[model samples]
Target chain A: MGNLLEIKNLNVQFDIFGAHVQAVRGVSFELNVGETLAIVGESGSGKSVTSKAIMGLIPNPPGKITSGEIFFDGSDLVKYSQKQMQKIRGKDISMIFQDPMTALNPTMKIGKQIMEGLIKHQNLSKNEAKTKAAELLKLVGIPNPDKRLDEYPHQFSGGMRQRVVIAIALACNPKILIADEPTTALDVTIQAQILDLMRDIQKKTGTAIILITHDLGVVANLAQRVAVMYGGKIVETGTLEEIFYNPKHPYTWGLLSSMPKLHAKTDKLLAIPGTPPDLSDPPKGCPFAPRCPHAMKVCVDHMPDYTKLSATQKTACWLLDERAPKVDPPATIGVGGE
Target chain B: MDESREKLLQVKNLKKYFKVSRKDTLKAVDDVTFDVYKGETFGLVGESGCGKSTTGRTIIRLYEPTEGEVLFDGEEIGGKLSTKAKKNLSRRMQMIFQDPYASLNPRMMVKDIIAEGLDIHHLVKSDKERMDRVYHLLETVGLNREHANRYPHEFSGGQRQRIGIARALAVDPDFIIADEPISALDVSIQAQVVNLLQELQEQQGLTFLFIAHDLSMVKHISDRVGVMYLGNMAELAPSDELYDHPLHPYTQALLSAIPVADPKVERTRERIILQGDVPSPVDPPSGCRFRTRCPFAMEICAKARPKWHEAGKGHWVSCHLHDDGLKK
Candidate 1:
């Protein structure tokens, strides 16, 4: 499959008063056709910032894409103006936000909202748009689609509202769908339903999916490949098994061990100590060096480059250095997938 | 860990209904029953609007129970209690709120905020005594006395939760109801707070009624757990037993839906996806609340509410399939 989207050395910054917050620092990745790529990170780790930067949704003046190129359809989106980006956003790449209530207009009917994109991008008439909207709703597995199209945002449940939001995102058959924690706002059962529906949609449409979430479980559940971000940088990127089974970076290890599992009974979870580094004045060396358990003396003085583990896996960590002392993840910690 | 281990708190057929309109009653918590043993953590989990929080609030007498009994230490304290008795009850049972930022007063000093319980019951004789108590609590929850002068906004989410834990411990209560205590914190910080809770429970011999929507985290810390759906207890059993042998369809769905962090298991495992959202508690279904989303739903499920029974040893479940084993 061809690469649907490729981001190269992307840098994003926000100026809050006199201080500058480096939100995304040289983050790069690729999304291939019909493949799911999950970006996993904690808050302030720049996971959400990377997704927003891709959509050209970052507020300018305050938030700016300072450097790098976002290549989609063999073109750079970083230099694209607001008007040009609008066309690409709806027709080429669409995003489904975490909260459907905030994303959807409360007063408008569900059908009109779903049809707006179809009518505008596909050039369909009002009656034709209505027919397409119903099909979209049914595709997202909303029951009794014909009668439900007339309902408002509040009339539908949280899960149904999220389903409607997905329906809208798929209305134009966008090439790439960036779902920013799409199921985070819904319940677990509903989250499963949404995740299943998204997988079904991807299989049918062969759409490239970019799933952004803080939950490692969700990443495991959906993504074919995983990129673990920490302090605005892609610390580790690999196939799902590499990230889960043989994660090298201390940050990725900490994240995986921090979460308590369903099948395993462990006395204590290994929490990563300390908070994320301040983006206003980031650390001179590796940003995660402060909290890294396997951090070496050189980690504080210099940042490590990505070490290629395999064709699909690369990790940035001082522990990967040949000269550094060998250290392993704590014994009590487990993969505990089942 | 035995049958006669002593029930620290017994909630018998409790109900708490709010008057939404003059005629319409919002049944936030309907006839639910459970017991918290001494020094055991009892986890209550459900999705939003399932009355898990309401049950915790009602047990602490934050809201007056509309019906049924809440017996603590063999004394009924559900209805109209004397002010002195209520004040005494407050000292015996304290609550840790879900939102640390909103729970702590922004204008007040951390020391004063944590000592709010100390001053209420007149637990301290002098200012030095109160300060000493506050400082001791901070250290107990992994903070130092240096945090006494700061405000709630000064701390991060994890630190703020630690301060919240300190506030709850200042009263030296027998039972602490934590309402989604770690939900507000990030993943890295969640386990820290959970560890702290477990440590304090061991040190002080405290009984916890942990309320949260996260089933995985709840399963980690809870001794026994109860599954709630639309104001009713769908299942209740020991944590391991419940997770290992889930009988109720809702419980099975809830457990299966939790995404495992390992990709191999996630890809291979069969997930049970419920069909619809939780029905409105105001006009709940005639029988089981889960029948709307249950995969093994039968005609009898709608006809009558399934009787709560012990399907296996120490595992209680409410489902028509478990009502009585029969040829279908």
Candidate 2:
């Protein structure tokens, strides 16, 4: 199948205190229709920035797209005007934020909040919008949708508030939904419920999804394809099986090993030492070279080229460099080690 | 695995009710009882507002218990302790808060924060001695001694947490209550903090009541785990047994909800998505608080609260499904 969305050679930068901070650099990926693509990274790894760039949500003045082409349905979105982007934002692409309490307006009733999108995008009348809003609430599994529509945000629980947010996101029937850590604030059970709800909705509407999260567990079950991001770049990209079973990047290995497994029997977890590098004055070569376990002398001197492991898998690491000697990941990492 | 010794920390029918309004009392923690072994990590796992944090605070006397006796080292705390006695007992217990960012004073330097406990207890004689103790505490938590002079804002989130650990350790307490210490940290940094706590527990022979929202991490670090729901403990068991054979329906649904990192396992595993949100703590359900959302709830569940009793060796559950064996 052809790609639904393709982002090639993307670069995003911010001018802060008379210095350019390269947030995202040379990132490339493709999302197929009806596929759930996950972008996983720690804070300041530019995972959110990449998603924001794709949605044309980057705030102007300080934030700028340095160089890249974001193609949606064979049309470059980077060239679209603000007026043009506004029309496509809620109608073609929708985003769900991390905190639902803050994302939702406290004063307005949830029914009105959801109806704003339907009336604006679908051009529904007041009464028609209210009726459609209740239907959307029911679709998102809100109990007694008609009665609860009159209730304010404070009356709902954390999980229920998120369900309302999901309802708002789906009000316009967008072709793409970008959920940025929608479940991070919720408990495990509620997180599971929200993930399942998203999967079910995606199946029903055939909307492509971009799930952004720091938790690898969410990506493992929800996403069809996985993109491991680090230091403003796609360090590794592959199918879920290939990423989980045979990961090629050391950063991906650290992520897998650092996660506390529910079934594994181990005394101590293997933590990756050191923090993410400073983005203001990034290193000359590989961005993750400072924290990589298999860091070589050449890694500091030159950036490793992207090596194709398969038609669907690729990694950028010195260990994968053809001239470099093969170095295996630790034995403790079960599936993703050589 | 000795089970015959006197309990180190015994809580009897603990209750912590918060008055949200004049007419309403939120039962944040209601009618809970448990025991922590001498040198084991007792984990409290639950969702938000489930009274896990309240239970920990009530045990430590951070929040005055509405009704309960917290027997620590064979002595019941709260109102019973005289002023001098409370001061003496303060040296034996300490607590690490959840949010490292908000818990630490941004204006104070790291040394003063760690040395606050030492100064309170009068552990050090001179200023130099206090600085030495503070530096040693920083080193013990895998932080550099040079960071002693820096402010909390100068460090990263993980580093601030290390400072929090340093502060908790300065008192050299026998028991520590880590209330969701790693929940606020990054995933990569969480393991580091957990490992540090494990090592500290072993070296100091300190008992811990680790309260967290993540069940997988709780299972990894805790010897015994307790599952709480709306101010009541649903089940308590050994870590391995709790993960392997969860008896309570709430626990089964909880364990099933943890998303595995493997796609194959995730696709194949059946997830029991609970239908409703957690009932409000204020004016909670009449009998079993979890009955409102429980899939296997029976009619009797709403009539009376189930008795919390031992179902098997080292396993306890509070549910009506196990009543047949109890009756027999």
Task: Give me the candidate number with maximum TM-score.
Answer: 1
> How accurate locally, in lDDT, is each candidate?
0.90, 0.89
- Label model 1 with its docking quality class: medium
Tens digit of lDDT per residue, candidate 1, span A2-76?
888999999999999899999999999999989999999988989999999999999878999999999998999
- The residue-level lDDT of candidate 2 at B33 comes to 91
True contacts kept of 2: 0.74
What are the RMSDs of all candidates, in order?
Answer: 1.4, 1.9
Show the lowest summed lDDT stretch of 10 residues, model 2 chain A.
Answer: A329-338
Q: After superposition, how far is residue A256 of candidate 2 from its true place, in Å?
A: 0.6
TM-score, structure 2 vs. true: 0.97
List of clashing residue pairs for candidate 2: none
Q: Write the per-residue lDDT of candidate 1 for residues B85-147, one digit (tens) a residue.
A: 999999999899998889989999999999999999899999999999998999998887999
Q: Model 2's A-chain: what TM-score?
A: 0.96
- Model 2 chain B is weakest, by summed lDDT over 10 consecutive residues, at B319-328
Chain B TM-score, model 1, reads: 0.98
